[model samples]
Target: MAEKGGIHVDSARELFPRVAEVPFDAEYKFMATFHNMTDEQGKPVVRCCVKGAPDVLIARAGYYWLPGRDPAAVTDENRKLALAENDRMAAAGERVMVVARRDFDPTTFDPKGNLLDLVQDLTLLAMVGIVDPPRAEAKDAIARCHSAGIQVRMITGDHAVTAAAIGHELGIEGQALTGAQFAAIPDEQLKPQLDQIGVVARVTPEDKIRLVTMLQQKDNIVAMTGDGVNDAPALKKADIGVAMGITGTEVSKGAAVMILTDDNFATIVKAVEYGRNIYNNLFNFVRFQMGQLVAYITCYLLAAFFFVLGGVPFAALVILFLNFLISVPVAMALGFDKPTSGLMDKKPRPLKQPLLSTSQWVRIAFLGILMAIATVYLEAIYEEAGVTTAATMGFVAFALLSISRGLSARSETETAFDRDIIHDRNQMFLYSMALLITILATELGFLQRLLGLTSLSGDQWRICIAAAIALLLVDEVIKVFLRSRLHDVKAPVT
Candidate 1:
């Protein structure tokens, strides 16, 4: 990291009597200063000035300081030995690199004349290998991903043998392919086999982009993780681009939609769980609101038709008051619903699937029409008694049906009284409060007048209450039928 005593050399033209400092890639920096003494001992040495493959000192400049004259540092013999050593260590899953620095003459080498410019004559110092074992929890995380029907792949610019060795150690099983092999494969030929190729090694940035594009064409939702300028294109191309905040280049981070502060792979699993829940919650809100809207329109039209009224029973302000005090609050509370069991056990939802299907819309229509019929039937009975109570009772039924909708919204399979609903205290409270407020508003004299409604007699109130209860009863019966239908639909055949 530092050179205090040695005269700096610029290339082989001017050599330092002894070179002191080198880059992080110079793994022998610690077993160093013996640098010169060790060089005399013939330690697999090669000369490096400022250029070559920037291995461990990736993306950095001026970090390397070498001082030698010979440009033939990488002779055929040296390359052979280096490759042999790299293979040996890599077979043991070690990341291996050869360190090289330059020898310099002490008097002529400039200590301060632009370190990068002057330190040109490079020398091969030593070959150092490091083993960065995966984290203890990484295997477990991968296992969880597999269980949840997710696939994990490793793509790197590392050597094929080294990458494969590491993949095996990490319990990753897949056919190995180099970037060149991938590039050579025709797109049509590659589609079916793409899922089998796990470890892609010696890949350039273009290879990564091609992989992402190919995966997308196969209708796979690809989430690409990267942390370099070269990674920007593929990251942008992915369905979800994740960047490592700590180590990612600005270009890559800008292209990515999600940035991982800790850069932990397991964090992605957690994110997926939350993302699915957020979407489910949004759907629940939509399902509830849309159903309520449909039911209100149905019930309002039926009552108006039965009573021969030209206009709606409720005023515009009444609708707003009811929505504010009832619907919105309850919907907001539904957002807090706990994630269902085995949230991560399911495969990823289809990207093409809509939030609601046609069948769900039909169910909504049925629920709405039922509420309308119940309300209209009650309105007719009250009007027949000459009590002038049908209109007020119709409004009550509307509020009541809206309140009961939460139960249906919570589950498609589970009934209102099922364990999933009964055990959820938040949901129970939300349901209770919505029902209580709606009932209270209809009964309260001041609120009823404010809503432009006449007060109902006690007996008439009982009738409205009975009719409202029927809507829930009808809903429960429908739920039971629906549950049975679902069971039959899902039943495995012999």
Candidate 2:
């Protein structure tokens, strides 16, 4: 925006394209870029002028540009009109800049000195409105975050009206607070209301850092996003620092933990979804392995206590077949389990929460006992054939039952017969291979000799397979009970 002797030009770049083409000398060309400053005597206006050029100074400010100028040119009616226009543009989610110009003598101008005194009696130029609309997917992303129990906020150096307008459009709820108001309030008062503030306007770098610190003190997980050099401190102080790859300065990028290459808010939502999926996958893997260990230990100890004819429950090679051949492959396959439905609908887990929750522990205990009992029952039924034969029956029964447990581990609440597993072809194929390998190891003549196992008769095989199916059925029943109980239950984060 440009003006000369009361004549206004809307397109400044088009009017002086050649003058704008010169390579920028960053230090002196753009002086007093407004961000978090109150000049001497508490004035908010800032002046910027091109170095080594004509003595024309361009000033940008909010509503404060009405003072220290010619009252005849900027009459009361014009001042009211300008302020109204500024509010109109700001409330429409456009950044409003009040531009005014003043010419000085070039020979007497000092680039390093204060230019606030030189802006007196300025010619009121145009009140230009700039629109930097949010990305198309940003609103949807913010909605997703809210559904996931995540709070999003906007901290900008724009006018409070502009920030509030943008916050409302993005579905962020809360009142807007300016930097001056924030500084006036004590931290004790602000902490309780921090969650209720959706936008913070005209904040300095120090104010941003303080805001992050306040949120962290309340156990809130703060993810700060920025693209400026002044944002480095706050970015580093945040729990997750997101940098705009397209427009971010090098300092901001270096301070951030994650960089948005596309500079889209939707990407952050997708990242959260994938991150939760990975965390769930890890939890399931650990639970699967631990539950299998409990099953094996309980079975061994029960056998040793009930039947005394054995030096060992199973041979050394047989132990290897149970773990490496059957358990490890299925455990690894559990890592590929997709996120369960409504994964993001749950609240975030607490920072101090344990890896295994209490509910998870209870489920593991119940399922592990059921599996052990099934394996021991098979051994008891076949014991008269001798300890070796009983051991062989127990090994095969344990391996098959363990595979069923792996299937159930794919979901915390969903049963084995649920559509979750039925629709996951990759898991089904991998599990089928594990069962096939276990059966081949026992039935093939050379393999049976290598594994130190006795060949099972058709009747014995029937009992073992029935035992495996019984374990699966019982676990599925328990899951049905859990689903009913936990349907409306909220996940505990503390």
Candidate 3:
């Protein structure tokens, strides 16, 4: 049946008839047959004859049928077909030959036309015509890798022209060099030329190893993919080695970190994306942790500074207590927040880039300043009202900072009011921890005295809550503006 771009047969009978089936035990001594047979003198002895499969055949006597053509016209059509097929196989890095049979003598047989010769010739034919095509996903995967700022280079033992054609089909960039090209260069010369070549063709096993080393010299994190025994050494040397589980040699499989079950390049792309996402999330977690540490250090240092100047009032201790108990948990919650839309679009950050960027430092500094200002304002109001009223206000401010920190932990991608953040079981656990710490600190005499003892009146407590809400709103607005202007700087792939 005709299919898109090609033909398909549902059964063998559609192409050739199965007129009879030979019995399993039937004694069969196959003969080496030839068509258009000629002796050493080159004279045709026989034109054509019908027969069963031959035990062996001459290299020049095998015939192939041309689809939609009559068998009687095979002689004329086959010559043209042979030329075309030879060119096709040659382009695909395959050797090609015609196979034919010898004329049989009933009484006298020549040893030169022996079964061994036929077998050897058939072996050569099989070797010449075989070619393995690239996987369907190779092109798309290569393209995606290019888009992601990853370079792909193809190394194959095929002839230079054939390998170059395959590289072109797979979208590999830059020039292809032969194994000889690599071997001729000294290490000194090769080290400087690695960037100019992308496809290495007609390469020996040793050449692949050297090519990998050259890329590494430039500090690239190379990923090697191989399916042969010859590929093991290079595969082992790569940062990430991939092997084809279906067709890979045992040595290659043993050397690789990952195996492609279907030998599909697309699977590798998916794996890379997953790896980047995991790393990105880990980066976010570390950043959030550092923010907490900064907050803790800043609050403690300021409190110490005030104490050294004179005796720190109980109200000041209340502010520090609230900042630590409330802010740190909220920051932890931020670690689990969903990533922004352009998370993967940004290039990977450089390995040498500082963990905290200038923007991040500025944000942390501003947060500390804002928290310090809010504490000072609450303490002043408490002092004006009376000692009892002031103590109550201090307690309220402490509680408010704790809750406000939780609200602020939501990422800039989402608002604090987003139900998802509040409902997260992990966030809930952190919030619970913060609340428990606050209550324990307030109830324990030593802790309460250490932080400056305080109990809140209902009215003063309400004022503190109002103040916390106002501070959080201002903080969120500042974050929104900053995030709007701050473009994501992608990390460089080293």
Best by lDDT: 2
Q: What tens digits encode model 1's per-residue C-alpha lDDT throughout 110-165?
A: 54444454344344544556688888777777777777778888887666777889
TM-score, every prediction = 0.73, 0.84, 0.58
Clashing pairs in 2: none
**Model 1 regions more than 4 Å off:** 1-46, 49-93, 98-129, 165-172, 308-315, 385-388, 418-429, 452-494
The residue-level lDDT of candidate 2 at 182 comes to 82
Ranking of models by lDDT: 2, 1, 3
Residue 345 Cα positional deviation in candidate 1, in Å, after optimal superposition: 2.6
Encode model 3's per-residue lDDT on 182-230: one tens digit a residue.
7898999887777767777657778888888888877788889999888
Write down the RMSD of all candidates, one decimal each: 7.5, 7.2, 10.7
Model 1: which ten-residue window has the lowest total lDDT?
Answer: 25-34
Please tell me which predicted candidate would have the highest TM-score against the true structure.
2
Q: After superposition, how far is residue 385 of candidate 2 from its true place, in Å?
A: 2.4
Tens digits of lDDT, candidate 2, 256-329: 99999988889999999999999988888999988988887887787788763362566778878789978987
Report model 1's TM-score to 2 decimal places: 0.73
Using TM-score as the yardstick, the better of models 1 and 2 is 2
lDDT of candidate 1 at residue 227, scale 0 to 100: 89
User: Between candidates 1 and 3, which one is better according to TM-score?
Assistant: 1
